[model samples]
Target chain A: MAGGYVGKILKVDLTTKNVSTEPIDEGVAKKYLGGKGYAVYLLYQYIKEYELKGLSPKDIDPLGPENVLIFATGPGTGVPRFPSPGRYHVMALKAPLTGSIGSGNAGGKWGTSLKNSGFDGIVLEGVSDTPVYLAIVDGKAEIRDAGDLWGRNIFDTTRVLTSVVGGKNTSVTCIGPAGENLVPMAVIMNDEHRAAGRAGLGAIMGSKKLKAIVVSGDQKVSVANPEEFKDVADRCLDALKKNPVTGEGLPTYGTAVLVNIINNVGALPYKNWQTGVNPDAESISGETLSEKYLIRKNMCWACTIGCGRVTNVKSGPFQILASEGPEYESIWALGSSTGVKDLDAVVKANHYCDELGLDTISSGSTIAAAMELNEKGYIPEEDLQGLDLKFGNASAMVEAVWRTAYKVGFGKYLALGSKKLCESYGHAELSMSVKGLEMPAYDPRAVKGIGLNYATSNRGGCHVTGYTIAPEVAGIPEKLDPLATEGKALWVKIFQDFTSTVNSTINCLFDTFALGAKDYGELLSAVTGWDISEDEILKIGERIYNLERVIINRLGFDGKDDTLPTRLLKEPMPEGPAKGQVADLEKMKEEYYKLRGWVNGIPTPGKLRELEIEV
Target chain B: MVMPIVNVSAKILLFATLRDKYGVRELEVKCDGTVRNLLENAAKTLNKGFLARIYDISRNKVREDIIFTINGRNIKDIKGEIGIKDGDRVAIFPPLAGG
Candidate 1:
């Protein structure tokens, strides 16, 4: 039990109503680090054990009682000194959406609270007989009845849980009705607005009949070598404050700042990826949001860069009381992707998604796909239940948010996500997704490196998994031609491996723009007293990434699955700076496979041996 | 004999806080020089503090915080000495970060 971790993992089996605690092996901790990495390792172990018992991968159901959910925190998490220390934890599970490993990280007080409650992680197994919420306080755990809180939205559920739990310091992470209803697009909301918002992790919670987890404690998280840790932590904080992206840009405009920039560059995927640019994109840009809607700025717990937006819309058709964000992804998903130019409507939809416990990206993308279907006469007017689910129909878009959350009429199909919705119509190619998860805002046709990243990402079409956009679009470390596939494979592999480490450390990936791998290594070493080198830290990242890839491979995904939709590959971007461009995936995927020591997107045996992964 | 100087009309585009401060999305500046010279000319329209924000006053180079892209390519890759031709688009943005 060193400085960085509580050194204990809480295991709860709801089917048997049995709970246990196990000591974290120092060797495993050193190799995998924590957060997503730890979760992936644990999942691999679980699956291997199950296989030994004669259970096949095909027999495993993502939403079934056998699926495991891990909420993990890194060594630097909850440490006030680390840069962007507000990032508390990441949740990992076999996603109901992609049916592979699904991981989502959230920044809020909940993670710090979990650490203070004296556990580095929590493993939830089996299915509860009825709706219940887990309450963990100062190392003690309880599976309490949540029958009354079962059907409530995230806002109401949090309120009820806070009052019922009766501790002012208590923080809650819970699912809303969308999760309870088993919507594959459901998200887990923590502290009301922050979400573990991708890959249908919330549906897994719902399937277990788990409503929420409330935690609070007064225990102190102490770092090893306090003096050295303080020095390193201070340097990190100063670097974050001085860095332009973290200090000035993020605080000033929030992430929506990218809307105008991306749009100007012809990379803001619009109207279901039909085009890469939207003329009215400025209507939902960060500038517009800050000018007309931003009430104030908010920050995650212990974060210096307050990039979070607190917005309100008053005296309009899109009037909302107040909400935390309609971040860049949400804006692009609900606004540009659907061709709804009204900022108010997008904001209202964002609020609805947060309250309803839905991943706005998937939900909005699903709706946008349906809108295209409706526009093309594939979905009849009667099929939409008299609602005009047409592109740019702001009113209908807002209504669709509620109906989708409730899974009513056509909303039920929308709740199934864009991939399923499109497949249901016999046009699966129309769904802009990689492996079953809906794609985010950035058009792959415009950014070749990002296209490769999307195709190769282990968790479906996630952007943050690699984020080649930093070099491709923003010129963070250096700028690369967005249209060039040359050397992009090398960059993607480097970024993916590095990102895996960052995600596992459970720190915000935004910190990477400011701090280098050495900075992260220093922080971890100072906190954990592990004496880890930067090279070793990067190797840990590679190991974690390879482990996840192997798990997905075992789940039947291969090079064929590591691909973009036909639209990105075959259809050209009709207008904008990237006109006539398509993702040159074949060229890049080959380089990527070679560089990662992967054959046909599966990690090679030699690569696994090099990473020291047994399976 | 002096060589004939061909002036280039470079469109300058600003984003985010830069846009809010500059009060304009884009402006056209005609100059017969390199990208650095064009930036210097554009700086004439901005206050000294704002100018300093986009350039390293000590290093006499484009500030790392300011991303300057000429023709959709980062000037850092092309370098400031890269010649600018007429009708070239130069985009200036503060460090923009988001998912």
Candidate 2:
């Protein structure tokens, strides 16, 4: 294989109970990049087989033994070029939540150790009769019994696995109590902090009766040419370390720093987007959190810029003694979305979500939707089971987090995600989400690009793919009216394709936030010794986008399906400089489709050929 | 009266848990003039650390996870420099918040 590669793929067949090794060829790595690319490639190849069979009895049951889950690491992973290589993903059958191709990323030393353990990827198939965890040590795979670790939460599971593996060098990725219980919104955790926290893939794992995958090894991820790789990668890494966002901003405050900025700009979705700003936002802001509870800051491996927060609210009224965050999205979703901006309450919510192994964003947004319905005279107060589920009540908010995890009281409805929860209440318009996933902190009425990303994201509503507002709002590249949608479609397309490329490489998306594709490509070329131009790299991104879209299409989603919530389309901003603004989604969507070279909603044969993707 | 076109620069260091944010552990900037100079002129469209060069990675540029210290005092404790002098590290980095 070419540069920055581990050069092998491990395919384990659970049905026949066989494990096979596949060599990673340079021809594919040079074009597809890594991780997500390989996942797409493998998925496409597998789907092609199903197509040839033409919907046979074996093909219909995706949950059956034939379905596969790929845990993939890319070329740049565990390499010295970029500090953030935590983009490894688990991609497989339709999730119970969105039923889209389940793709979620988590960061830790797990991917690195897996590479060191003599494999670039792991493809698990069939269903094992016994519950077991995969332990890979230097190319050796053992299906170890996880009988005692089966029922534990993420925290306890991590510790128990830690004790079982017996080393800090051991990196663990596991599902928790929520996943084991098969909650539709359950998540998978890595490094005790990082998570594959979307689309209830954990439920899929739980369905398969898998508990944990602990990896540790000393194998180094190899690069094409060491001298050139080190020079360019070192420069780029140094540049990222030197970047204010990567270097200082994120590390010091974590994503929670968005509390003040988004709140100040009236972009924070408050009370479930019914309001623009949170009145009690400051209570959960980085300023207040740092003043009261910040214990320290932390970062992922090879990351020069640390944005993860470590906090302790020892004497707060909340049940949590101390913990990391209430990050920005969670603060918005759990804090302002629920109308409970209490820092202590936010901390408790974060800790419980971590323990339960659930995505706080989806969980919080779901709670907010429920509260909105409750206050709107829809769900009876008794449905809340005597809990006064009002906006801005920290006590009730904290309880909601636990209840949802435990699936108690009013939480069963919330476990269904925002789309289903509101639909059940016959107010589907009230849920401010695309697909089934809820929107993050950015309100499209204020930041148009963020809206575009959320609406068009393959993973439903998401921001990690395109954070264009950093230039548009934060004035990083340039300042534009947050309320305006000028040239937003083109900008969104650039960010999308580029982000898709980076994420596929199995590297951190944040590393590219500071620089453009050219600089990132330089590092890739240096590390891989591949003649990948910026245009080629971007095209790879387009290929991944099309691949994901094709999967969605195969699962039955299309341009007509590319839709925003009725509220975001019809509602005007209630307050702030953008009082009358709403997302110009129709224009952005049309432009996006044109840029992607799709015919109507379907991928054009020409564009597919141009990317060398044969269907 | 003439405005000074002094070179402004700042570099951040990683300590405690803040070290994770940086892909590396340091950065340098060639900001134009005064404190207001780069804030008003540099590539602000870039991320803060890229644009501000030595600006600490604090959320909102004023949040708690990161802060810049000058002359043994926190930048928040002082003028915080409207602009930096050439070769000034500005000592931007993650704050000391852990036990």
Candidate 3:
């Protein structure tokens, strides 16, 4: 067994109530590493099997029993002193919202506990006639009836399951009312509030009738070259501690630190991206959150940079005794984008999303789109059922969150996400989405590279896949002209490919702000006893990215789907420092396609062969 | 003929650690029409340590880690030659980002 790998995979077929185990393939581990990379390979193999049976990848229903869901971690995960190794990646054959290859990564104790419980990953297949949950304790796995646990919110579900499983390191990952109701924007939450929060994979679990997965154990991840691993880890840790981003800024303000910086740069999308600046930004910024609501800082297991905010609203209608975050994206999604400046209401709404097991980005972005639709008078007033679905109506915004979770009233449309919701209301152009998934807080109109990244991201309008903001806005590694398109395609491609590799390592993306590709190569080589190089690391990442693209292609997406919303391309930003600026996507995109060796989003045969991807 | 060095006031916006350290979000200062002049004047008004914190005394230039922008344009984009005008928003942030 290689260092950091648990050597076995747990497979459960809910339909037949069968539990099986498989040994980790050494060749696959070598090529794909683990986590997202390994899982993508597995999903592609499953798609090939479907093809053999004469079923097209497009025929696979996202919410159907045919879709496969995977929970995977990398060779770096769970190892002691591995920087932020407390995260895991989840992938499904398709996402209910995007219909592209479903992917989400989350941080907390769950991933680490699973590895400690003697498994490298878990593969969930088929559907159950009754509600069930998987429990893995020590080295044994079992499927137990979850009849009593269904329909509970995420908090209660996690609490009940943890007590039932009773172990020193037990952790639970599960869906809630939103998932049980099969809300298309539902998320799978673990460790109380940490979420695999995009692409609605929770609904996939809901469709499978699986409620939760409980894991607990005391197994320590073995390190192959302890002396060299320690030396490399110590050097990386020093770098992380020395870097201002990973060391001080994040520790002081949490992720919401970007709220003000991005706003100042005139890239903070507001009121459904009608503009790029929010005048009331300070009230919801990281500095304000630290000043007013914070109880203390929180962190994932084995994480050194404690960026998580433990907070409370103290005394208000939106008051809560305890909560975790309305991180930068959450604050923007629920607060600025919807024009709700009330931090209390934003916190309350964010908490509701956590409890109800919802993706904060999609949930809030969908509501923002609806707000536009309502303001334009396109939505029938009767459909609202007296709810004021207007921008800046903080109270109504808070009410909309729970309604969407339960799929009640107007939330029925909101549950379909922004793309479908806007299209259903005769105003598809108002949706501020790309490839059916809602984009994050960054306005591509203000930052040219992020716009290109949004259009070309494998999992739809995602920032984390390739956060060009680091270079374009926050100026990590280096600074670039936010409005300039020159050389942005190459930057976006490198960031995207590098991010793919980082996700497979299954650690916090924040680590990359301090550690570079060479550091990762050294760390992995030391841990796995493989002489990995920086070039090889990037190559593996490119292979994983291309394979994911292949899966999406089979699912009926191509170059045409690689696009931004019409508003970003045509409707120039109206105000702020970036006034009159629009995302010049075409120039950058043409160069991007050429650099990628892709023709209209599909990878060429030569490119695939170069990456060692089996066609 | 020589042009008079007229001092113009610019709005200074600070964020993250800079804000916490200085205990102010925005300020105004007069400078002789350049980003460097504006920063230098603002540093005097902010505190003695402000200049020391953002400038590399040995290199005799603004520290590489400091993110200085004029009206949302990074100073690096302009090769540090961007001239500041009256009421221009000059925001200074330390190395910081989160997704």
Candidate 4:
């Protein structure tokens, strides 16, 4: 086994109550690395197992017992002094909402604790007959009854589990009422506020009658060459500390700092992307949040760049004594998307998302779609139950959050996610989602590369998958015209492939602001004792991306599904710096398919073989 | 026959750490229609640190990391001989990113 691996995977069968361990395959580790990449490999293997039992990929329901869910860590994850090593990736065979590949990544202490508990990952198969939770301590594991803990919100569930599983390095990753209710946009929250916050995978956990997973241990993650690892890690840390984005801008105002910068570029989606500019953007800017609400900055385990906001809304209708965030995505989704410029309300809505275990992006976008539906008279007034459901109604937006979590009255509709909610109301185009997952803050209509990325992302409508915004908007590494179509296809493909590797390594994407593929190659080689070159790192990423694309293809998604919303493709941005600009998707998609050696979005068999993928 | 030099007034927008450091969101400055002139003119009322960060006195050029956009278009796109017109909005930000 390579260094930085626990060399074991804990396999739990909830239906049969069978607990066992599986050895990590070194060859698999070489190709996939771990986290999203390896978890997808495990998911694919499970899919093949199911196929032998007469279950087809398209027939596997996301909420069914057969849906494989895995929590995985990478070689970089939990390695001491690895820059932003706190992140982990979770995967499911299918996502309830997207019906595509299920995936999400998060940062907190839970991933580190899981690594310390003597496992590189956990494979959950079969559904429990009753509500239960998993407990792993010092290399031992068991399933415990969680009937009493099933109905609790994330905070209460986490608090109770932490005390019950008391010991050094204990942490809990669990579902809240939203997941328990089987809401499609439910999030799996860990370490209180950090979330694997997309694809409704939490509902997969909920469907399995699992409430939480508590991990506790003091195992040290060992590296093959400690001296060389330390040397590379120290240099990477210095780069991160010196880089303005990671060292200063992020630490000072958190991710919310992008509010002004994005809005300035006119790519900040506003009011359900009807316009690129928000007239009252500054009122909810990061500057205002830091000035009025921030208590202090927080960090994930071993994170040098503490972008997490520890905030408080002391006295307001939306008063919350303590909260973790409304990161840039959350702020835009909950703030401007719904046309709510009130910072307090955004903060309050954000708090509800964390406590209730709801994905703020999908939740806010759903509400924004609902608001549009209501204003257009597509939704009858009586269905609202007097909730108003209007754009810019801060109080109503806040009310919508808990309602969605608990699936109360109108929230039942809201909980359906924007894709379903808008479709049910005869306005599917209003969803602002691609492949059933809502996009984040960046307006794809204004930025061409992000648009192409969103249309083709393995996971629907994700910005982090490619994060072309780095070059298109922030001028990182190099600057590109956000509105330009030329060369963006290459940029999107490279960013997507590179991001796949990073997600596999499973560190914070912010590290890329300072470090690049070369830096990651050095770090991986030193820790894993592999002669990983920069080119090889990218090859690994391309393999993972192509493999994910193949998995989604088996689920019945095709080139037809790879597209931006019609509004983005047809409607030009009405006002702002990017006025009259529309996403020229087809031009870029053509080039992208050629670059990936894909035919109409499906990878060619030759391409798969070249990447050493057998499918 | 020499043409009369007309001063162009532009709105200088600051973001991220630059906004926090400068203590103002936007500044109205009159310059001779050049980005360098606009920054130099804005530097008169602003503190020395502001000028030092965005411009190098020795090199007499905008700092490499400073992202300067005139009317929402990057200065790099327009290349050399870029001009800042009257009523233009010039956004200045230190290199920063988050998703």
Best by DockQ: 3
Q: What is the per-residue lDDT of model 1 for residues A252-275, given as tens digits with 9 covering 90 to 100?
A: 889999997788678998899999
The 10-residue segment of model 3 chain B with minimum total lDDT is B73-82
Comparing candidate 1 with candidate 3, which one achieves the higher DockQ?
A: 3
Docking class of 2: incorrect
Which digits, one per residue and each the tens of the lDDT, describe model 4 over residues A339-444? 9999999999999999999999999999999998998899987788888988999999999999999999899999999999999988999999999999999888
What DockQ do you compute for every candidate structure? Answer: 0.58, 0.04, 0.77, 0.74
Give the C-alpha miss distance for residue B97 in model 4, angstroms. Answer: 0.3
State the lDDT at A153 in candidate 3: 91
Model 2 ranges off by over 4 Å: A56-66, A319-321, B1-99
> Taking the tens digit of each residue's C-alpha lDDT, what string does model 3 give over A404-517?
999899988888899989999889999988888899999998889999999998889999989999988877888888888999999999888888889898789999999988
Give per-residue CA lDDT, model 2, range A531-582, as digits (tens): 7778888888888888777777777667765777877788888776467777
Highest lDDT among the candidates is held by which one?
A: 4
Superposed model 1: Cα runs more than 4 Å off: A88-93, B1-11, B28-64, B70-89
Query: What lDDT does candidate 3 reach at residue A69?
Result: 96
Kindly report which residue pairs in candidate 1 clash with one another.
none
Please provide the root mean square deviation of candidate 2 (C-alpha atoms, Å): 8.6
C-alpha-based local distance difference test score of model 4: 0.91
